[model samples]
Target: MSRNIEIEFKNIVTEEEFQLLLRTFHISKKQFFSQKNHYFDTKDFALKKLGSALRIREKQEQYELTLKKPADIGLLEINDVINQTEANMLMNHSVFPSGEVKDELHKMKFPIDEFFLYGTLQTDRAETEYKNGLLVFDHSFYLGKEDFELEYETIDRDKGEQFFNELLEKLNIKIRYADNKISRLFKVIQGKKES
Candidate 1:
């Protein structure tokens, strides 16, 4: 298991704007990478109530469990790698891998035994360098919903905020509130269950 601080800015954008940004940055469809996030939380959304998210992301042949929580600079991300069998068990709600991640959640008073797989989100992502930062483009789909987003990752929070806003303004894109993938997926899945 490993822990780290993540500082990234995201802006919601229309598909047209997403395409324009891609073309302007000379990024092509072939450059994108794809990943799937299998999300989990207690049935009552305990993690969501705490403004945290849990997911097992499958990228290429690798699987990682990630927990994200709110922090001063950005989000504090905790990650742990798991094998295919373990990932399958988690997805099937048959097991919870024990380790530092589970220990941390237990510390937060979450009933780790109640965790369950709820939904999955897929993202086609691409990244490039801009102004000493990582510029990212994402098109994600989940629970019959799709959206496009632009992101910038940087150590300089102030410059990142400035650069992200200016870039949006230059592209004539209005910033719309974009919830993180797990939260959005949970809302949709919960609604589905209710209906």
Candidate 2:
């Protein structure tokens, strides 16, 4: 299994400051990538607001599966739909979803009420940090309603472990043991209340 280091904060930076900090961190706009927009004329299954979804994400020659549920957002239950799409990148290293891969998977056109964008920072590994309600994957980050974000991740297990240790030393965040089980950021967000 791949290893990862994740950190979440209360978003201490303003939108402008956050954008500046990303640049200071040497992040660039070119790294951002978007999935092909598709409208599904017919869905195999009618997606529900409170149901679970199994998602398989393919990125940078790697693949990961994630199981996710809807967030506490009201309305048409778009959070779960967005979560399933976001879970692929979060489960794999923080690389953006491959347009080609998304295209290959979406065989038929479907109605899309919303669109999602993601980016990655690759350095032997990746780190996805969530701050100020924005999911910053590596260098490129995006903000949207009902969307999910991931913090740092490493494809190399050893490097990931090192990053995790470093983060623990530097920040007062909690680390969850990474197991080959279903996982998602919403779970962490919801679980943080007890910790």
Candidate 3:
């Protein structure tokens, strides 16, 4: 198991803006990779209510389960590597694997057994180092909806925000509301249910 603090600034961007950034940054198509996030939550969204999220990320034939909780600075991400069998069990049977992630859920009083696969979000992503931060470009598709996003991840909050904002200004992109991927997916799912 591993733990880390994630501090990042994000902005939802238009397709035109996304393309512009790619060209400006000299990011080739070959730099992009695909990853899938399989989100999980209870029927009542207990984890979401607590401002936490859980997902098993699939990339390069490997799986990692991560639980994100609010932290003083950013979000505390607890991750555990799991094999294909373990990943399948959790997704197919709602079985919580024995690890730090499950233990954390227990501490939060979440009914882990009730957790089920919420949905999946797939992203074609590329990353580069920019101004002492990790800059990310994502074109994601989920639930029949597609969007582009720019993310800057850094340990320094103030500097990261400055760089992120300046990049947006340079690109002529307005700052817009950009929810995290899980939250975006949940909103679409909830909207579908309501409709």
Candidate 4:
């Protein structure tokens, strides 16, 4: 597994603002790609209570298992590349790939047997470099719900925040309180189940 520190500034956007941002940045459909994210958690949201998340992402026929935990800057992400066969097993049979992720889970005191696939999210995304950071545009759908988001990822948190805040103001976009995609998707799934 490979580890990386993710420092990102994220905000929700309306459809009108989404389209405006795309046009403002000159992004096209050709520059975008799609991915399906399968999220896993315990029935009681054990992982969520601990401020952690697990998901297997499918993009271009490749699968990557990612675990995110709270970190000082943003979140610490650990990723493992697995085959389609393993991914299918995870979705169909609730089997997680055996590797650092599993080992780390055990180390973190999470009962491996409790986690299971809970929901899925599909996203159409476009990304580009902006102000020394990677600017990402995402339109995601899950559980009959859809949302648009703008994100900027960079190593320097201070600079990233400054640039991100100013960019929103410059674009005439209102600031929004945004949760991470997985958390938001899980909430939507939970809401659907409750209703």
Candidate 5:
């Protein structure tokens, strides 16, 4: 298991803007990779209510379970690597594995047993280094809906925010409120249930 703090800035962008950023950065199709995030939450969104989330990310034939919780600066992510068998058990049988993430959930007083596979969001993403930060471009699909996003991950918050905003302004891309992937997917799920 591993733990880290994630400090990132994000912005929603239109398809045009997404493509523009790709061209501007000289990112080619070969640079993009696909990953699926299997989100887990209670029916009532207990995790979301606490501003926390859990997911098992499938990338490059490997799976990683991560729990994201609010921290002082960004989010604290507790990650555990799971084998294919463990991944299958979780996705196919709703079995929550035991590990550091499980331990962290217990510490948070979260009902870990109540979490089930809520949904999955898949993204075709490409990332490059920009101004001493990692800049990410994502085209994600979930619950029959799709969106484009730009993300800048950095250790320094103030400088990262400034650089991200400056880049958006320089590209003439109007900033839009962008929720993280899980939240965006959850919103659609809730909307569907309401309608």
Candidate 6:
């Protein structure tokens, strides 16, 4: 199984300072994780919506199934299948829900356009923290819920492809393309005001 590694930080710097930070990291604003493939982009209002979602505490495990068209983004997902007890139990074993069992129960269809940027950290257990009004998840953290707060942007397919390639190079992270599905934890927020 492939591991994901990432960290979320509050954007406290000015635009120029932020640019400088990107240079230091050898990345760009576009290289930051966002719902780039969705119909929304990271705008002020969208960020508010996402922030609201981030404030909730509905925990569960997540599962994702990616596609090919959007080179960097996943095309489909099956998220939040495990509870806390189950997660703890399955940590050391390769446990997957049976397809026949899922097929027996009619579940909601996976949202197609939704996309997320996820990276793991080096730890045995993942961690989640609410820092400076942002919900930050450490690499090993997985809550079995889907509280994705994001906006989408529209880009020409060619441009989007190029952007993904550049991002891979800038981050120095190997890019993997797959139609396989995976699991993680989820946390959903109800109606909440922005901080």
User: lDDT winner among the candidates?
Assistant: 3
lDDT of each: 0.88, 0.33, 0.95, 0.92, 0.93, 0.26
**Runs with alpha carbons beyond 4 Å of true place in candidate 5:** none
TM-score of each: 0.94, 0.26, 0.98, 0.97, 0.97, 0.24
Write candidate 1's Cα lDDT for 91-183 as tens digits: 886487877677789889887878888889999999999998999999999978999998899988999999989998888899887877787
Report, for all candidates in order, the number of backbone clashes: 0, 10, 0, 0, 0, 28
Model 4, 1-195: lDDT tens per residue? 799999999999999999999999999999999999999988899989989899999999999999999998789999999999998888888787898888889899887777888889999999999988899999999888999999999999999999999999998999999998889988887787799
Global lDDT of model 3: 0.95
Candidate 2 lDDT by residue in tens digits, 99-145: 43234224323223222222221221123342222334322221221
lDDT of residue 139 for candidate 5: 96
Candidate 5: tens digits of C-alpha lDDT, residues 113-161: 6778989999999999999999999999999999999999999999999
The TM-score of predicted model 5 comes to 0.97
| TM-score top scorer | 3
Candidate 4 segments exceeding 4 Å error: none
Cα-lDDT of candidate 2: 0.33
- Name the runs in model 2 displaced over 4 angstroms: 1-24, 36-148, 151-158, 168-195
**Model 4, poorest ten-residue lDDT window?**
184-193
By TM-score, the better pick of 1 and 4 is 4
Question: Model 1 compared with the native: what TM-score?
Answer: 0.94
Instruction: For model 4, name the residue pairs that clash.
Output: none
Model 1 error, position 103 (Å): 1.5
Better-scoring candidate (lDDT), 2 or 3: 3
